[model samples]
Target chain A: MNAEAAQPYRLVVVSGGTSDPSSTRMLADRIADRVASLAEARDEKVAVSVIDLRELANEIATALVSQLMGPKMTRAIELLGAADAIVASAPVYKAAPSGLFSSFFHVLDNDLLIAKPVVLAATAGTARHALVVDEQMRSLFAYLRTMTVPTSVFAATEDWNSRELGERIDRAAVELLLLVESGFAEKVRTESWKSYQHEYGSAGGTELDIDLSTDLMRLATGGSAAPRRKP
Target chain B: MQFGVFSVSDITRDPVSGTTPSEAERIDAIVKIAVKAEEVGLDVFAIGEHHNPPFFSSSPTTLLAHIAALTERLIVTTATTLITTNDPVRLAEEYAMLQHLSKGRMDLMLGRGNTAPVYPWFGQDIRQGLPLALENYNLLHRLWREDVVDWEGEFRTPLQGFTSTPRPLDDTPPFVWHGSIRTPEIAEQAAFYGNGFFANHIFWPSSHSKRLIDFYRRRFEHYGHGTQAQAVVGLGGQAYIAKRSQDAVKEFRPYFDEAPVYGNGPSMEEFTKGTPLTVGSPQEVIDKTLTFQETFGDYQRQLFLLDHAGMPLGMVLDQLELLGGEVVPVLRKELAARRDPGAAEAPTHASLVAAKYGDAPARQPRPNANRGDNVTGGSPYQDGDAQAEYPSLG
Candidate 1:
């Protein structure tokens, strides 16, 4: 929604940290602050919500094993669904982001995050895992078909004492804000929705791209339902 | 409305006993269960088709034919006869043969079975599942309706004047129900043909069913099949009942926790609340089932999964008894009480014959003595008075 018209932009932060005093959640909070300040600087209002996947670890495991999303997962999904921009941060595991983070997205409907601008960040113990955001998380978000901001912020133990971490965070947050302010996600949702598969049961716009003249649809509407795409 | 039981035919080990029923034992149990479906007051019995181990019913027609021969009243069907891998021509012939054998007491639900390896086993590509299903069903629709089908589609070889043998009984094909859980296009296809839409309602949430069923109903009305209320709908549910609800849960927990499809995913309570699986007394089952009608509107058929997760043969039979005697009779009356009078009855061969002929004599589809040229013959039969006109799209 256009902030000048009706509603402020929705920003969702997903933190995949497993422990207290988590550096992953700390990066997510900083990214959220940077994005909010950037949007405020541009005279645009934004509403931010944080989803701590650490709290939902058991639920995620159950959903993975069961193929059913319980109530907790559903709330997390809802927050993502309404997001104009996403700040996703996960602590590095092995050489990649946490499996808890990956599984949470797997449990989501495929079409949920298409073309949304996602700012990628990760907290690692050492600089050796610094490319976790670029090498792993970038392609992960790419699979969901989200537009990852060019500048991905990575926080390592040494980077916390350096100025580069704050600089990268500012760059990533500003890039996300630019995309959000330009309504890029909404544009993709509206303009290219037909290019994606329309899941029937999901709540969204249904009137835009349903081709009524297709044989099945023609049979469905009995030749009387109004023709879509008159031109 | 018709109410019945459908099984996946999984030969699972009893989680409590660690004893897996032998294939022979499971097979015998399934046949007995089907027979018991009719022995009680149930109206339908559907068996699933699986080519792999752990699931035994490979030839549904053979099994259904056996059940049909054994029972006089019950409607025998497939939970889903795979539409993607199986040839449509064979489908037409085999189902017609089943119809003849059953004496017009069979119908089948079609699905794009998600078992990936089965696709390659049958020489089909899993990636083309949707298109294969669509094109194959388009041809199958023709094979049953048209006397001579000249067909070409993306997945299969072109047919040159293929005449699928043993025409459907009464010159009216068995009614079909399309079973879908998530795909909207499948619901669209079911509505397109004015066929029944069966939601696999046990695994998924009611919101999912509500959306798909409501979509089908609206499209059914749009397609001039009927008002949204008059559209034919079938739902799959699961219930385990005892005299007391707690006993039902205690008895069913092990089976529920270890079953292949949904085991180890959600707690029984979470699953019960999220989806349609109910473990309770007869009264509780009845109460939960009534909510289905309230949610999806008055539907035409309700099929429950009674025998899965290696519940003992004795327990399965006992569950069927409760379902048929205690649960279904009440559901039949309660579902009927609020149903719109003008809504279509569950379609059967006899009902379809009545629909095709009204009071007139239904066509017998007599065969010619020896017709060599099925391609050029104006009518392929000798007593070719009433060759029904079919859509020539395929």
Candidate 2:
């Protein structure tokens, strides 16, 4: 058996929906379910964990203002850090993703989601926000350096009942499954994590490597900025 | 352990009184507060450096010098002198002058000031803050120790043959504590030089400070300063004390609600729980503080943020009374008992002088007669190396 068949992939679903029975969360759950079923069909397992952003609203706001991560926020970060793949869903508001969705990612360490496989999905009251997923949200995942699937899922009130949305979800789920099976995130993290810029405690406080060979580190050690000029 | 108060030097309006103290009034009030710190048997009084309004201490040394002359035992220092914006040459000269005026009762903490606008006002870029701070401090380090420095650095003009005059009091550079919230480079810089690492532990959780402190300690040991247990560390905390916990909470709530930085974000109870803020009785404050030692191992200094958030002078004085009378005494005794045998002591000028010059007299730099050229020819001071050479312009 291959490495993917021997161990379960940890898939984390982040829903930025505020209501109890949020359609945004429903879209994410649908995508997550599809991913798990697809993995199981290949004799692979997926452990799905949901991070309901509404539950962490206060923590997110507190973190943005004070840089103090509440327990719930810390737990969410822990979930994201270990996630092999992610299903990030947000509610579209004012031609953009919800402020809560954007703010949650804003407080995260830049290096936390690097090289992770992600499936971008969004829900809105009207079908006009269908482009919110690829147009607005994809750039955010790109900035985080996540490998987003070629197919993105978007569900408006009308599309929720349509067959096309289901097809899109399946296409995205297969893409995510293949990426996870490839172990791309793990390979990048283990092999090339140092190629990315990282602060001292970035990557959910796990990026603790200190490179003492840089010009800044040299200056930090009482050496001049230009190494060649030093006698 | 050493206990003291450090002010951000904010001239914030009193939320209860609904009145802001003018810069003149706040300036006078800080001097009184520093004097009161000594009167209440506190060890250190540090003021922050700010170049903007709503804060008065643009020149910390000027205020600290007067405070030092007023109080005998109190050590006047900075919450942080700006290492990013200020010229390192001026810092070396001005602080050396402060060290002289205070008669060896001063030390300063260095930090990169976070205000973005303040950087451009001083001909600096905020993007270059870390390198600027690191490079500036490297120059300042040599300026104080070496009588005539032949230095070149990235951020500032190269010094061909420059002397930061009024040489350090007793020829011993004042002890420096590098204060940082999250930057490990600052901690590494401190460790590489065997300087003290201070964590401004007021805003964040203990776990965050613990990570940096742990890194600093490990790196301090790696640099062979001493064992991890012997690394000099300082922590900043926030507290408000009354006889009753409820009363303390009630009194500090309004100020805590409207205070700068963290105000309006989290409730007082949440903040006190999440951070090192302790709004309770003196015993409760002492218990919370003792946990810092448990969390960070043996630390040297613990400075409290008691006077900020527009707390009236009388209220701040009352807080100090409780702190000096009930809290710090017990904390001192407890921390002393629990201190690791290998832990370093809180740095003081006298101790630094003693370390630099055992039983011998400390060197007092006297300048040679001027050559009427604006630059000292070979060595600036009479006792410096006479054979030292500098390239001539002619």
Top candidate on DockQ is 2
**iRMS of every model, one decimal?**
5.0, 1.2
* DockQ score, prediction 2: 0.75
Q: What global local distance difference test value does model 1 have?
A: 0.85
Q: What CAPRI grade goes to candidate 2?
A: medium
- Please give the TM-score that candidate 2 achieves against the real structure: 0.97
Candidate 2, B66-116: lDDT as tens digits = 999999999999989999999999999899999989988899999986678
Clashes, model 2: 0
Q: What do the candidate models score in CA lDDT, each in turn? A: 0.85, 0.91
Residues A78-137, candidate 2, lDDT per residue (tens digit)? 999999999999999999999999999999999999999999999989988889998999
